[model samples]
Target chain A: MRKLYLAGAGNVSKNLLSLISNLNSDIKIMGIENSRGQLFSEESLSMADINNFMKSPEDYRKSLNISKMDFDIYVDMRTASKNGERERDDYINLMKNGKHIVTANKSGLANFFPEIGKASSEFDKKLYFEATVAGGLPVFSLIRSSFPSFTVDSFTGVVNLTSNFVMKKVNDGMNLEEAKRKAMEEGVAETDMTDDLDGTDSARKAVIIANSLFHKPMRLKDLKYSGIDENNIKKNEMLLAKISMNKEFSVESRVFTLNSEDPFLRLAPMGMACSIGFKERNPVYISEDMDGPLETAGAVLSDILSV
Target chain B: MRKLYLAGAGNVSKNLLSLISNLNSDIKIMGIENSRGQLFSEESLSMADINNFMKSPEDYRKSLNISKMDFDIYVDMRTASKNGERERDDYINLMKNGKHIVTANKSGLANFFPEIGKASSEFDKKLYFEATVAGGLPVFSLIRSSFPSFTVDSFTGVVNLTSNFVMKKVNDGMNLEEAKRKAMEEGVAETDMTDDLDGTDSARKAVIIANSLFHKPMRLKDLKYSGIDENNIKKNEMLLAKISMNKEFSVESRVFTLNSEDPFLRLAPMGMACSIGFKERNPVYISEDMDGPLETAGAVLSDILSV
Candidate 1:
């Protein structure tokens, strides 16, 4: 049996636990943690228990008798921005301890790819993060498994859900504040929307894709990215956004004007799409519908099974 | 070094050899065969030599000095329908002789999957056929690597290029004969187009996908499929075609009328697309551009690398 340690007790983690608890018997949840600290469970955590723990992890941190860090797989689903560095450190420690990792956390991979990647290779542990971009779409996994058979000259797509949602709403004649508010109400955008609007989220995904798909190490800070400034959208006008990598492996990510027939333009609100061009064939297009929290959980589950 | 044997010297085989000769160094071609007989090469077969041999295999078969059947992988790219059972026997013989198999041939799998699959597992050898569906689109490969991660509730797509081409041409106001003639002239349809228009090709692909993806022991004869009969179409009529798997793993493939906005209706001319719906999330749509012999070779190469 493979022991799995979860690093986040949020909705994504809960959903994954719920999925695995019912379907998969080979993998068991050994431990769980949040901002406060950690809690251990030899038996698989029940959905109600996971919910209770998510509601208040600190309450159980002091009561659980077992506190083991030894696990076969470390699943990182934490999304708190402030805990980014700590989460990275936790991942590094886990890898150093010979633990395989599956993550939906983009910050760790996009920001500390070299260190995490180095540790993973040095320890010879499997590291999977298909959920980092295009939640549950299998974009990254598809490239990793298929690119060996063909020559990919470049790739382009809409990897950001929040910006796409907001931009789509704006295109439908909604005001900036109204669109953002609607997105937030629909759980499409986080309360702190700077990351999405400022293009940080998309840039992080681009960096991860570059590193994983093209084997190019790109930093989010060094990437040239422009986000949708809702102020720029005129009333009832259309807006288009896309992220692309050129033949030189140079990355370009921004919102721009494009014809409706463009493959990138077909992306729906909160949907992610990618077009990979090969040397002698027409481009391969893959896209997923609106990515919700449950979808992110689905991606996380996909990684867990893959690892 | 891994030795790879070619069982056919068709255009697809030639393209794979070209790709492997240029990109991959781990796999080296040791022998090749055509309809006449087999030829051996001490070194990798050059593109010019391959072309010349393809033009007149009997001449090369008579002149080649070295001949050997011992190889690590047997690449079957032969498309002769009359050689179907013979090819199946060859595959079983090769597997029994401890050789892995990679094939672009559909008749063998669509007809003799049980025996081949049993032989492969019994001998502990790999048998890969990623090129069997959607040309070089990696459809089967993607499903193999990723579907195990999630619950694939159902799948639907256009898996036949010839039928898609014929239908698109028919929709473009061409008569049945004109459409078929144009498809054949473009090499999109086989000269004997019965397999494609009669839905045998698509049904074969469906059997392969069902057997491979869902682990269902399905046969071609058990499947109900309908192909495009140009006589059934009226001028300026919109025709929508798709291959879909239901929740019970039963497959439904036919041409019907769909809304203009349906993703199933958005297929390009000679392009193949599939939408796979999971248990909880939206469907994942993957499509490839117009497939030619070169693309089929790309798929075969993908299998070679994977094996």
Candidate 2:
């Protein structure tokens, strides 16, 4: 039986625990850690115990004793860290301890992909982070499994769900501020939508895609991106990440307005869409509906199973 | 190094040979067999050798000496057989000889998936046929890799490229016969477009999907379907495969008209699309452009790499 150590007690982690509990698999959640503390058990934790722990995490206000835990995989679903230093250190340490890693956190991978990737290879452990880019879209997995022998020439995508929602509202004639407010009220945008509107979020995902797909050591600082500002926001415009692999990987996150009849523009407001261009083949288009934490957790579970 | 023995010299096989030649991989084409003859080589066959063999197959018109060949994988890209008896026997024999199988032929798997699957499992060999349905769309691979722990409840797709072409032409104010003729002229429809128009091809693919995805032991005879006739063909209507798994699996192939603004309707005329519904998650939408033999061969190569 494989044991899992969850590194967050947020909604995504809660959804993952619920999914695993209902699934008829041998995977068991051995522990869960949050900002306050952690809860660990040799036996698989039950849903009730997990819920209670989430309700009163202060009751278990103690740091995780990593050396004493017996787990096969470490799942990171924590919120994005500014510098990713803490998450990066945790990932490296976990790999050194002979544990596979699965993550939904983009900051760590975006900031320190090569370092984390090297640590995984050095420890002979696998790293899976399908949820970090487009939630539940299977972008990385499709590229890995379906195009194993093909060369990816370029990629273009609208991966930021929050920005997509805000843009759709703005396209429908609402002002930018009003649209952003509506998105937050509808739970479509995070409370702090600064990174999302400033193009940092999309740029980070682009960097992750380049680092993983093209094997380029790219960081967020290496990219020159422009976000959705009120002055630049147009009626039918949306933020897009355009990545090309020539002599070097060129990633640009900018705003573009697709034709009205374009299929990519027809994607749902809460959907993520990407078109992968190949060397000598027709591009493959993938679109997925990103509802909430459940979908992200589903991607996380998919990565877990892949590992 | 992996050695591949192709079972056809058709367009898809030729495309596969060309692709493998250009690919920088360890896979080598060792032999090719068709109704007219067989060609074998101890060393990897070059593109020139393959083209020459195709140009004058009569020069190499001899039965394949299976026992004398050294190959690891057998790729079947032959045209669909009526009963699939020959292909089934070949797959069984190849598995017995300790070789993995990759196929782009649908009839064989549609008619004898259980038998072929059983042979693969019994001999501890792998069977990959991503090109059999929705060529280059990555349907089976996506489900296998991305939804390992999820239960697929149902699927709806417009997978028949020829029928889609005909329907689009009819929607554009062309008669059925004229549309079919144009498709044939453009090489979008096969010389024998009976199965494609009559829904047999779509039903065969539906059966294959059921047998593979749902693990159902189904046959074509078990399915009840109706072909597209002049009276039945309507404007904006296209062939759809609706498959559901309740207490038992239910598969139906019929004509349906999607909304004008529906994203599925916006798919390219030569594209294949599917929406897979899960038990407790948002459905996944996959669409791919099926330009021709090259795309199908790409899927076949992906399967080969997977094996």
Candidate 3:
């Protein structure tokens, strides 16, 4: 059986545990580590233990014995970091200890890809991050699995569900703050909405896409992005991220109003969609109707299985 | 390096050859077998040789030396067989000779899955048939790569583009015969449109989907399907294939009119789409704007690389 050690006891990790419990999978969760500390178990954790951990994660984090834990994969469900230093260090350390990494956290990959890539290669460990970009949309997975030897010329998508929901609500006559508050209430927006509001989240995703798909080394600082602002927001406008390769790769995330007949305009409030342009064939469009912790957990599970 | 042997020198096989020519792939086409005879080459065929074969496939089939040919993968792009006897025998022979099978022919798998399944297991060789259903839509690839442990409950789709185009044209006041002729002229309908028009094509695809996705063994005779007829086809009606798993697995293909608000109804003329219902999650919708031999060749190439 493949053993998994979750790096964070948060919503995505809890959902992943529950999801795994319902499936006839060969995966087992042997440990969970949060900021409080770490929890290790010799055998796979049962549903009752998972429930207890969910109820009081702090109490379960009493043991920080990492050297004794025998796990094959390290799952990172931690919250996004601005600088990604802590997540990068954690990933490198875990990889150095002979653990494959499956991550939903984007910041570490977006900010310090060269270091992480080098470490992963040097350690001969695989890394899967399907949930980092468009949660559960299978953007990276599709490209990796289906489009072999096909050159991706560009990618344009509405990848941020929180900002998309907020913009749609604002377009429906709600004020900016009210729209954001409604999004938060509906679990569409995170408690810390600064990244979503300032386009940093979308930019980070664009950076990852460029790095992975276009084979271009990019960083968050290389992108010039503009998020939704009350003064500049337009009716029917939503955040869009575009990554293209010409003479060089360009990544941008900006608030733009699509034409009335544009398919991106038809996406649901929580929907995420992408149009991928290939070298000589017609562009392929992919979209999902919803995005959340559950969906991200599903993506994480997919990566785990792939690992 | 992978050596691929084409079982048919048809449109899809020719397209696959050309597509591989343009890519920096590690795959090589070592031989091609047609109804006339066989063409064998010790070295990988060049683009010029591929073009020559395309011009007059019969001229290149001078040798029937299958015993001397050394290839790793066998790709089947032959026309649909009504009974699938020949294709089944060919697949078994190839697998027995230690060759992995990748096919675009649906009839063999649809009609003789048990034999093929047993041979594949006995030989311990891989079988990739992504091009058999939905062309390049990546339905099977997505399920294989992304939904590892998820239970697929049902699948509904507008899979046959020829029938869809013919029905749409007839709905616009054109007679059924003229619409079918137009479709053929547009390269959407095949010269032998019996299988496509009589719903056998859709039923075969339904059988493949049911067997592959639901893990239920099904055959074409097990399905009750109706094709597009001038007297029976209603306005805005198109062929739809539905497969469900209840007390037992059920497969059906029939002509039906989708509501105007239905997303499947909004698909382009040559588009193919499928809605996959999972056990406890939201259904995923996948669609492609176009389907043809080139797209099928793309899928075939993908399978070759995977092998």
Candidate 4:
């Protein structure tokens, strides 16, 4: 049985718990690891044990998080920045003690890589945070593990859900307020969507990635930030549709190509795109990929599993 | 210092040695595992060490004919059919006795999975073979080590360079022989391209991947085979270019897409894709974000400095 030390009980953490509760008998995920450090049973935690110790792999996995659940790896999906800091310190200590860590929080890596990395080397424990940048996409593992022989030249993306959502709506001929209204309702734009709209979120993702790709790290403040809102408007529904269908690389590449097709120049307040940023280290351009959920989630899941 | 046993020094084996020899000091890859077994290194060895007393991750992997290298992992890159019964049994005994086995050799997994897996479990040894499938990219660590939570849908890709090369040329107007000749000259097609074009190469790679992903024993013959040939193409350069950057959807709902907009893809002998494979098991995929060999040589030089 593996015990998970879940520091936060947010939507993602709860979802993760739900995913694992019903795993096979051979691999049991005990209750959350808390400051009290008490473990819980499946019934006590209210999570199902789908494996039944003898069920088939597919059935076991469908009912549970994975047919072969390995909760020996701990997960931390906290959204709080302060908790992210605390979690980083805790990871350092745990790594020194040979404990493995899996996290959805990007702030963990953005904040404390050197300390966690040194301890991981000394203790040989795993510290993975693939979910920090991309939502549910296997991005980190692809760069970190699979292609150990390669070095990244640069990273750029079309990040910022609010910016993308707002721009996308604007291109469809909707007014700024109308787009914001729809975005807010659809959960596409946060009530305080300013962070995403202003390119702060994408900048954060960029720096974290720069650090992960190479030993030399970059800071969020060092990036060239931009955003797209309702200013530049002349929608080609055909172009948008083609781009969405992956036929046109124009807008896809436009996310980071500053001074040329800059999304921020076309839109503002409700959208943003921070072009490539480099400060005293390797240059990288981190933006967004795809429309929903973000690529960070899948990557975090993959990184955590490396343990 | 890591000891490696190259059971068969074939195409992949030679390539792996070159890759390993070029590694830095942090990990040492000596020579083939059987250098001592052969008794006379000068006769059978390429990079034979005179004093073989040192055994561990501390030895320098400063030995290679095709390149300079060192490795801390054992890699078997031979085909199963090439390995004799004696070598097969001997390899099993080594694995059973707690020696690590890292190989892309089909027979190793086809014949010795259960026993070796049991032995690895008991001894806490690892058997890593990232090159077994998709020399195009790394998938083993991605699935097995990176994402333990997600259920893999299935993998699909243009795994055979031979077929890809043939199709590419034929699509660009070259005849079968001309395409094959060009491929062989470019080292893109195997010396025996016939097998790959016929789909046996893909079968081996798929089998190795399936065996690992499912954790259930299966053989090469278990899979339903598919192949690509020159006859499938017509003379259409524009369409050829468009198809070269293709995408394949997996049963898992994830899409595998490639971009040939880059110059390297345009110059390559074949236009191909290798994607996530495995059903009801966890899967791994590569990212478009990753940069391959940002000047491959410089990276290796830096690795040497690290060692």
Chain B alone: TM-score in each candidate? 0.88, 0.94, 0.93, 0.62
Q: DockQ-based ranking, best first?
A: 2, 3, 1, 4
**Reference contacts preserved by each model:** 0.60, 0.72, 0.38, 0.18
In candidate 1, which residue pairs get closer than 3 Å at backbone N, Cα or C atoms, i.e. clash?
none
Local distance difference test, each candidate: 0.73, 0.84, 0.82, 0.47
The digit string of per-residue lDDT tens for model 3 on A1-307 reads 7898888878888788878888888898888777766667888777787677767777864664463469999898987777999778888988998999999999899898778888899999998899999887788777777877578989998888888888888887898889888988988887888888888889888888888888787778877898888555677677999988766767789887788767787788888888887775566787777767777888899899877
Please provide, for model 3 over B209-234, each residue's C-alpha lDDT reduced to its tens digit, 9 standing for 90 to 100.
88788877767777788888856667
B108-200: candidate 4 lDDT, tens digit per residue = 554455555666677666666554454434455545545555555455544456666676677677888898888888766657776566666
- What is every candidate's C-alpha DockQ against the true complex, given to 2 decimals? 0.48, 0.60, 0.49, 0.13
Name the docking class for model 3: medium
Query: Which ten contiguous residues of candidate 3 chain A have the minimum total lDDT?
Result: A60-69
Stretches of candidate 4 above 4 Å error? A1-3, A23-75, A82-102, A108-127, A158-189, A233-254, A257-307, B9-74, B79-90, B107-127, B215-217, B222-226, B232-272, B277-307
Scored on chain A only, each candidate's TM-score is: 0.88, 0.94, 0.93, 0.64
lDDT of 4: 0.47
CAPRI verdict (incorrect, acceptable, medium, high) for model 2: medium
lDDT of 2 by residue, B81-110 (tens): 899887789889888988999999988888
lDDT, candidate 3, at A216: 80
Ranked by DockQ, the better of candidates 1 and 3 is 3
Could you give candidate 4's per-residue lDDT for residues A176-206 as a string of tens digits?
8898888898766668777666566655666
What CA root-mean-square deviation does each model show from the true structure?
4.2, 3.1, 3.0, 10.9
